[model samples]
Target: MRHKQVAYVLLRITIGVVFLFYGIGKFTMGRAVLVDGLVQQFAKTPLPPGLVRAFGNVIPFAEVILGFCVLFGVFTTMALALMGILLIALTFGMVLVPNPSIVANNLIYCVIVFLLLYLAEYNTFSLERLWKK
Candidate 1:
């Protein structure tokens, strides 16, 4: 029980910090530069150009918000669910590019996020607990 709790918090914090790094870099890069990078990534995919554009715009912002939520353990279930969906979308993007490392990394993140969601009740150290008082 103690070990699982430790693993859950550790994974959540680790993934959150990684996402924060990725998300913050996008903001510093600016929209045009970031979207240009995203465009290059979506180049091989058959997804509609507009849809790809939309995702490129939204993903970074979503990551920043969701990453913070997970890191602070606030509304963790909702945050974890979004993280899972993001990972799924990212997995597809990675597979399209056939980038094995990103795909594996996204999969690993999804698994940890999902497992944490399942055992979220055991998360005693979360800021979420403060709401109960």
Candidate 2:
């Protein structure tokens, strides 16, 4: 194997593990609480109440699925793209709400997501690799 392949594997493993852990954390903490908190947070914005609730309910599951895909190195590009988009939206939400704490948290996560994207070509170690075999 090449040095680039080694780097790819290492980055893919690290990013995959992190995403999986984050997704598990969301589920472990109780989805309803997470949903309610999101709803309340969004309620402060001009976004429709019903839409907020609906999105709140949907996000957790999406996170879990996306995390799983990343963890397993399946559909890596699509999974990373979706996660990136979600993080960007989250950053926007924090900005809109002007919550210092949330802004800090979202910013950190956004950076992580961006880093993952920056390293995405390294995901050649994933299913995409096997497919090429």
Candidate 3:
């Protein structure tokens, strides 16, 4: 295989595994707990409580979808962009909460997502081969 092909395969695998774990975590452990916390936090912000809860529920599905797309190398660029944006938003929220520990994780994930976005062209290894033709 070519260097580009190797890079593409690596990128796809890395992104897929990361997102798959994230989606599973979101659905199984983080969503409800984080949503309640977020509802409380957003209660102090300008955002409505209902909207906050709704966003919390929707975000997990979004992550799952994006993760699946990355795993399959489908719409690689768009999925990376979406993941990057979500990471950025998460980092921002962590900062606003003034939680140093959470902020650290968020920042790290944001950087990782950005790196993945930077390498999105190499995510051409999977089913997206048809899309390339």
lDDT by residue for model 3 (60-127), tens:
78888888887787877788788888777766666665678988876776676677677656655677
lDDT (0-100) at residue 118 of candidate 2?
81
Candidates sorted on lDDT, descending: 1, 3, 2
> What lDDT, from 0 to 1, does candidate 1 have?
0.84
Candidate 1 ranges with C-alpha deviation above 4 Å = 1-3
- Residue pairs that clash (backbone atoms under 3 angstroms), model 1: none
Global fold similarity of model 2 (TM-score): 0.77
Model 2, 52: alpha-carbon shift in Å? 1.8
State the lDDT of candidate 1 residue by residue for 16-129, as single tens digits.
887877888888889778888778878878876677788889988988999998888888889889989999998998898789998988888888888888888778777887
Give the TM-score (vs. native) of candidate 3.
0.77
TM-score list, all predictions: 0.90, 0.77, 0.77
- Residue pairs of candidate 2 with colliding backbone atoms: none
On TM-score, the leading prediction is: 1
lDDT of 2 by residue, 1-133 (tens): 6777677666656666766777678778887887788778777788777877777677777777887787678887788788878877767777877677977876776676676678766666676678879
- Give lDDT per model, in order: 0.84, 0.74, 0.76
Models sorted by TM-score, best on top: 1, 2, 3
